[model samples]
Target: MSDRRAIPPHSPPSPCVNICVMHKTRDLCVGCFRSLDEIASWGSMAPAAQREIIDQLPARRQSLKRR
Candidate 1:
Protein backbone atom coordinates (compact mmCIF):
# COMPACT_ATOMS: atom_id res chain seq x y z
CA MET A 1 0.00 0.00 0.00
CA SER A 2 1.10 3.58 -0.64
CA ASP A 3 2.44 5.47 2.40
CA ARG A 4 1.14 8.92 1.50
CA ARG A 5 -1.79 10.27 3.44
CA ALA A 6 -4.61 12.14 1.73
CA ILE A 7 -4.06 15.85 1.91
CA PRO A 8 -6.82 18.23 2.85
CA PRO A 9 -7.75 20.87 0.30
CA HIS A 10 -5.93 24.14 0.82
CA SER A 11 -8.50 26.65 -0.31
CA PRO A 12 -11.66 27.18 1.65
CA PRO A 13 -14.70 27.34 -0.58
CA SER A 14 -15.58 30.88 -1.57
CA PRO A 15 -18.32 32.71 0.29
CA CYS A 16 -19.75 34.22 -2.87
CA VAL A 17 -23.39 33.41 -3.42
CA ASN A 18 -23.53 35.24 -6.78
CA ILE A 19 -25.23 38.33 -5.44
CA CYS A 20 -22.23 40.34 -6.75
CA VAL A 21 -23.46 43.74 -5.79
CA MET A 22 -20.83 46.06 -4.33
CA HIS A 23 -22.23 48.43 -1.75
CA LYS A 24 -21.38 51.84 -3.21
CA THR A 25 -20.15 53.59 -0.07
CA ARG A 26 -18.60 50.60 1.70
CA ASP A 27 -16.95 49.14 -1.41
CA LEU A 28 -17.61 45.57 -0.29
CA CYS A 29 -19.62 42.93 -2.08
CA VAL A 30 -22.92 42.64 -0.26
CA GLY A 31 -23.13 38.91 -0.74
CA CYS A 32 -19.66 37.88 0.40
CA PHE A 33 -18.69 40.94 2.41
CA ARG A 34 -15.27 41.19 0.81
CA SER A 35 -13.63 44.43 -0.12
CA LEU A 36 -12.62 44.88 -3.74
CA ASP A 37 -8.98 44.34 -2.83
CA GLU A 38 -9.79 41.23 -0.86
CA ILE A 39 -11.87 39.83 -3.70
CA ALA A 40 -9.10 40.57 -6.17
CA SER A 41 -6.40 38.97 -4.06
CA TRP A 42 -8.38 35.94 -2.86
CA GLY A 43 -7.46 33.70 -5.75
CA SER A 44 -3.74 34.19 -5.10
CA MET A 45 -3.71 34.31 -1.30
CA ALA A 46 -2.31 31.51 0.85
CA PRO A 47 -4.85 29.39 2.68
CA ALA A 48 -3.93 30.78 6.09
CA ALA A 49 -4.28 34.34 4.81
CA GLN A 50 -7.56 33.49 3.22
CA ARG A 51 -8.80 32.16 6.55
CA GLU A 52 -7.85 35.42 8.24
CA ILE A 53 -9.97 37.33 5.77
CA ILE A 54 -12.82 34.93 6.30
CA ASP A 55 -12.58 35.48 10.03
CA GLN A 56 -12.90 39.20 9.55
CA LEU A 57 -15.95 39.04 7.32
CA PRO A 58 -18.54 39.00 10.07
CA ALA A 59 -17.16 42.14 11.67
CA ARG A 60 -17.06 43.86 8.33
CA ARG A 61 -20.69 43.10 7.79
CA GLN A 62 -21.57 44.35 11.24
CA SER A 63 -19.82 47.64 10.55
CA LEU A 64 -21.88 48.01 7.41
CA LYS A 65 -25.06 47.58 9.36
CA ARG A 66 -24.07 50.34 11.78
CA ARG A 67 -23.55 52.70 8.86
Candidate 2:
Protein backbone atom coordinates (compact mmCIF):
# COMPACT_ATOMS: atom_id res chain seq x y z
CA MET A 1 0.00 0.00 0.00
CA SER A 2 1.12 3.52 -0.66
CA ASP A 3 2.18 5.63 2.28
CA ARG A 4 0.53 8.72 0.89
CA ARG A 5 -2.82 9.73 2.33
CA ALA A 6 -5.41 12.10 0.91
CA ILE A 7 -5.65 15.58 2.30
CA PRO A 8 -8.99 16.64 3.73
CA PRO A 9 -11.19 18.67 1.40
CA HIS A 10 -11.23 21.68 3.68
CA SER A 11 -7.49 21.93 4.12
CA PRO A 12 -5.32 24.09 1.93
CA PRO A 13 -2.74 22.13 0.00
CA SER A 14 0.91 22.76 0.60
CA PRO A 15 3.02 24.35 -2.13
CA CYS A 16 6.15 22.39 -1.28
CA VAL A 17 7.67 20.49 -4.16
CA ASN A 18 10.34 19.05 -1.82
CA ILE A 19 13.07 21.41 -2.98
CA CYS A 20 13.92 23.20 0.27
CA VAL A 21 16.80 25.35 -0.83
CA MET A 22 16.69 29.00 0.26
CA HIS A 23 17.67 31.77 -2.11
CA LYS A 24 20.51 33.84 -0.66
CA THR A 25 19.48 37.18 -2.16
CA ARG A 26 15.70 36.84 -2.31
CA ASP A 27 15.19 35.20 1.11
CA LEU A 28 12.61 32.90 -0.39
CA CYS A 29 12.47 29.28 -1.30
CA VAL A 30 13.65 28.89 -4.88
CA GLY A 31 11.30 25.94 -5.37
CA CYS A 32 8.04 27.21 -3.82
CA PHE A 33 8.83 30.93 -3.43
CA ARG A 34 7.75 30.99 0.25
CA SER A 35 9.71 32.85 2.86
CA LEU A 36 11.30 31.01 5.81
CA ASP A 37 8.64 32.20 8.26
CA GLU A 38 5.85 31.24 5.90
CA ILE A 39 7.22 27.75 5.57
CA ALA A 40 7.70 27.42 9.29
CA SER A 41 4.19 28.54 10.22
CA TRP A 42 2.27 26.98 7.37
CA GLY A 43 0.95 24.04 9.33
CA SER A 44 -0.62 26.23 12.00
CA MET A 45 -2.08 28.85 9.66
CA ALA A 46 -5.83 28.93 9.01
CA PRO A 47 -7.16 27.90 5.61
CA ALA A 48 -7.92 31.49 4.68
CA ALA A 49 -4.44 32.55 5.71
CA GLN A 50 -2.93 29.74 3.72
CA ARG A 51 -4.95 30.69 0.69
CA GLU A 52 -3.76 34.26 1.03
CA ILE A 53 -0.16 33.09 0.82
CA ILE A 54 -0.95 30.81 -2.08
CA ASP A 55 -2.55 33.70 -3.90
CA GLN A 56 0.73 35.60 -3.79
CA LEU A 57 2.84 32.75 -5.17
CA PRO A 58 2.20 33.37 -8.85
CA ALA A 59 3.45 36.94 -8.63
CA ARG A 60 6.49 35.83 -6.66
CA ARG A 61 7.30 33.20 -9.25
CA GLN A 62 6.99 35.73 -12.03
CA SER A 63 9.34 38.13 -10.30
CA LEU A 64 11.93 35.41 -9.87
CA LYS A 65 11.71 34.47 -13.51
CA ARG A 66 12.32 38.05 -14.60
CA ARG A 67 15.72 38.06 -12.90
Candidate 3:
Protein backbone atom coordinates (compact mmCIF):
# COMPACT_ATOMS: atom_id res chain seq x y z
CA MET A 1 0.00 0.00 0.00
CA SER A 2 1.27 3.40 -0.92
CA ASP A 3 1.05 6.07 1.70
CA ARG A 4 -0.36 9.16 0.09
CA ARG A 5 -0.48 12.52 1.78
CA ALA A 6 -1.24 15.83 0.24
CA ILE A 7 1.87 17.95 0.04
CA PRO A 8 1.42 21.59 0.74
CA PRO A 9 1.77 23.84 -2.24
CA HIS A 10 4.95 25.83 -2.72
CA SER A 11 5.28 29.25 -1.19
CA PRO A 12 4.40 32.30 -3.20
CA PRO A 13 6.31 32.86 -6.40
CA SER A 14 9.81 34.27 -6.25
CA PRO A 15 10.24 38.02 -6.48
CA CYS A 16 12.80 37.71 -9.26
CA VAL A 17 12.28 40.36 -11.87
CA ASN A 18 14.99 38.80 -14.07
CA ILE A 19 17.43 41.66 -13.65
CA CYS A 20 19.62 39.11 -11.80
CA VAL A 21 22.31 41.40 -10.57
CA MET A 22 23.67 41.43 -7.03
CA HIS A 23 24.34 44.89 -5.67
CA LYS A 24 28.03 45.38 -4.97
CA THR A 25 27.81 47.09 -1.60
CA ARG A 26 24.61 45.52 -0.31
CA ASP A 27 25.17 41.98 -1.57
CA LEU A 28 21.49 41.73 -2.45
CA CYS A 29 19.86 41.21 -5.77
CA VAL A 30 18.80 44.53 -7.22
CA GLY A 31 15.62 43.17 -8.74
CA CYS A 32 14.36 40.98 -5.92
CA PHE A 33 16.27 42.49 -2.99
CA ARG A 34 16.99 39.00 -1.68
CA SER A 35 20.38 37.97 -0.45
CA LEU A 36 22.27 35.16 -2.14
CA ASP A 37 21.34 32.69 0.57
CA GLU A 38 17.70 33.75 0.50
CA ILE A 39 17.52 33.28 -3.24
CA ALA A 40 19.20 29.89 -3.07
CA SER A 41 17.05 28.50 -0.28
CA TRP A 42 13.72 30.01 -1.30
CA GLY A 43 12.50 26.74 -2.79
CA SER A 44 12.82 24.88 0.52
CA MET A 45 11.53 27.57 2.85
CA ALA A 46 8.13 27.36 4.51
CA PRO A 47 5.28 29.58 3.35
CA ALA A 48 5.39 31.73 6.45
CA ALA A 49 9.12 32.29 6.14
CA GLN A 50 8.73 33.13 2.50
CA ARG A 51 5.96 35.55 3.31
CA GLU A 52 8.21 37.24 5.83
CA ILE A 53 10.81 37.72 3.21
CA ILE A 54 8.21 39.06 0.81
CA ASP A 55 7.01 41.52 3.41
CA GLN A 56 10.51 42.84 3.91
CA LEU A 57 11.08 43.46 0.22
CA PRO A 58 9.56 46.91 0.10
CA ALA A 59 11.76 48.07 2.94
CA ARG A 60 14.77 46.55 1.29
CA ARG A 61 13.95 48.39 -1.91
CA GLN A 62 13.64 51.63 -0.03
CA SER A 63 16.97 51.09 1.68
CA LEU A 64 18.57 50.45 -1.65
CA LYS A 65 17.29 53.75 -2.92
CA ARG A 66 19.04 55.49 -0.08
CA ARG A 67 22.37 53.95 -1.03
* Winner by TM-score: 3
* TM-score for each candidate, following the candidate numbering: 0.79, 0.82, 0.84
| lDDT of each residue in 13-62, candidate 1, tens digit only | 87788989999998999999998888888899888888998999899889
**lDDT of prediction 2:** 0.91
- Candidate 1 residues lying further than 4 Å off, grouped into runs, are 1-9
Task: For each candidate in the order shown, give its overall lDDT on alpha carbons.
Answer: 0.89, 0.91, 0.95
Return whichever of 1 and 2 wins on TM-score.
2
Tens digits of per-residue lDDT, candidate 2, 24-46, equal 88999989999999999999898
lDDT of 3 at 43: 89
Pick by TM-score: 1 or 3, better one = 3
Residue 12, model 2: lDDT of: 81
On a 0 to 1 TM-score scale, where does candidate 1 land against the true structure? 0.79
